[model samples]
Each structure stands twice: as structure tokens, then as C-alpha cells.
Target: MIAVVTVLLAFPLGYLLRSHLAANVAYAIAYLWAFTFQTLYLTLSMLGGDDSAFSKNEFPISYGLVAAGIFGIGFGLVALGHRVGSRRTTRQAVS
Candidate 1:
């Protein structure tokens, strides 16, 4: 649910910012920003000792996998939006 919201938010921003930066750069920015936030939240949850969901998992590896998956899907959408925005601008220029 959270991932969906993040992607939804990123896509439009990426589309709107298409002219401001390269697609890859925007994707990298989005990826790093999201990954950092996730890492920080996990670290704080563990340090705060508030019964972290990450700690309760029998398979600790799942956390990394889930984060990767979320980033993969989320950032892919960012790139897709960038591409769409680029195409839209190109079409407008052509006409």
C-alpha cells in the first residue's frame, strides 16, 4: 500500500520534471531518496526498540528483497513517466 502511494507520487513528479533533468538522473535521485528513507526508518525502528516488523521476521533477508522489489517497481514507474513526458513534449514540438 505504501509502495503504491510512493510510485503514484513519483510518477507525476517525474513527468512534471521531465524537462528539468535527464530520465536516468531523475530515476537515480528517486531511487536513492526512497532507499535512504527506508533504511533510515528500519534503523530507527530497530534502535528505538519499538518491536520492529523487520526484527520479527523469521527470514531477515526478506527485508532487503522487499525493499529491492519496491524500488524496482517504483523507480521503473518514474522512468516510464519521464519517457511519456518526453514523448508528449516531442509530439507537441513536432506539431
Candidate 2:
């Protein structure tokens, strides 16, 4: 799925971005951005006469929310990974 791939890709970038921002804030911002884009894209697709993605229904809205959540989780994983990585380095240096 595209959502999975996006998160997988974003995780590394999120880790790198942590150098500039705290991980929680960074992930929240990233999720909000991704959600905004997804909403816009879905709207445009509907306006362009694409009927496969939207309707007068709540399912699409929920799906979009889930997608954004997934991306946030992926971004958060980077922060988690950073913590694990730092611990390993310290242990290696000690032994």
C-alpha cells in the first residue's frame, strides 16, 4: 500500500529531521502535513471527475485519517530507532 511505503520512506527522513526538532513535535507536524496533502489530493480527484476515491460518505474521511496516523507511526519509529541506536553505540564504546 502507498501509506505503508510512505511511512517506510518517511521514517529515515524523520530521524534526520530530529536533529532540528524534537521527535514528538516532528512526527506530529509530519502527520498533519501528510493529512493535509491527502485531503487535498482526494478533493482534487473528486473535482476532476474521479469517482473511485470519494463520496458523500464518512469512510473516505476515516481512511484518510488512518493513512495519516500510519505515517506518524512511521515517523515515530525513527525516534525510537535513534534511541536504540544511541544505546548500542554507548555499549560498544564501553566494552
Candidate 3:
């Protein structure tokens, strides 16, 4: 699924960004940005007269939220990876 791919792709990017930036808040904001873009893309894609994705009663906004949640999982993994990475670097430096 697209969501799975997105999450898998986001995880490494989030980890790299966090490692380079040295700012946790920046990493959060960077990953959170995908939500706005995803929502906009889905809504606009729907409004452009494409009805292939959903039924008459369904909406794109909901799907975007779900996608964003998937990305959040990836970013959480990034946080974990960053923590582990930093610890390793610190240990090496101490020795």
C-alpha cells in the first residue's frame, strides 16, 4: 500500500534529518509537514474531477488523515533510531 511505502520512506529521512539538524523540534515539524501536503493533494486531486478513488459519500480529507498517521509511525521510528544512534556516538567519543 501507499501508506506503508510512505512510512518506510519517511523513517530514514526523519532519522537523517534529526541527526544532522541536532534539533528535535525541527525533525517533528519536517515530518508533520507531509500531512498538510497530503491533504491538499488528495483534496485537489478529487476536486479536479477525478472520481476514481472514492465513492460519492467518501471524502479525501479522511484518507489524508490516515496517510498522515502512517507517516507518524515512521517518524516515531526515526526518534528511536536517533536516540540509539546518538548513544552510540556518545559512547565512542567517551572511549
Best by lDDT: 1
26: Cα error in model 1, Å = 3.1
Q: What is the TM-score of each candidate against the true structure?
A: 0.62, 0.60, 0.57
Q: Model 3, 1-95: lDDT tens per residue?
A: 54544455544654455354443455455555755665566557777876665545665576667666776675676677677667767888999
Candidate 2 lDDT by residue in tens digits, 48-95: 878777774445766766775786566667666566656666788999
72 Cα displacement, candidate 3 (Å):
3.0
Q: Kindly list the per-residue Cα lDDT of model 1 for residues 24-91, writing each as its tens digit.
A: 46656666776677678777887687556666445568777886787667667777777888889999
Question: Residue 17 of model 1: what lDDT?
Answer: 80
Please say which candidate is ahead in TM-score: 2 or 3: 2
Better of 1 and 2 by TM-score: 1
Q: Candidate 1: lDDT over CA atoms? A: 0.69
Q: Which regions of candidate 2 deviate over 4 angstroms?
A: 1-10, 13-21, 57-59
TM-score of 3: 0.57
Q: Name the candidate, 2 or 3, with the larger lDDT value.
A: 2
Report the Cα lDDT for residue 72, model 2.
58
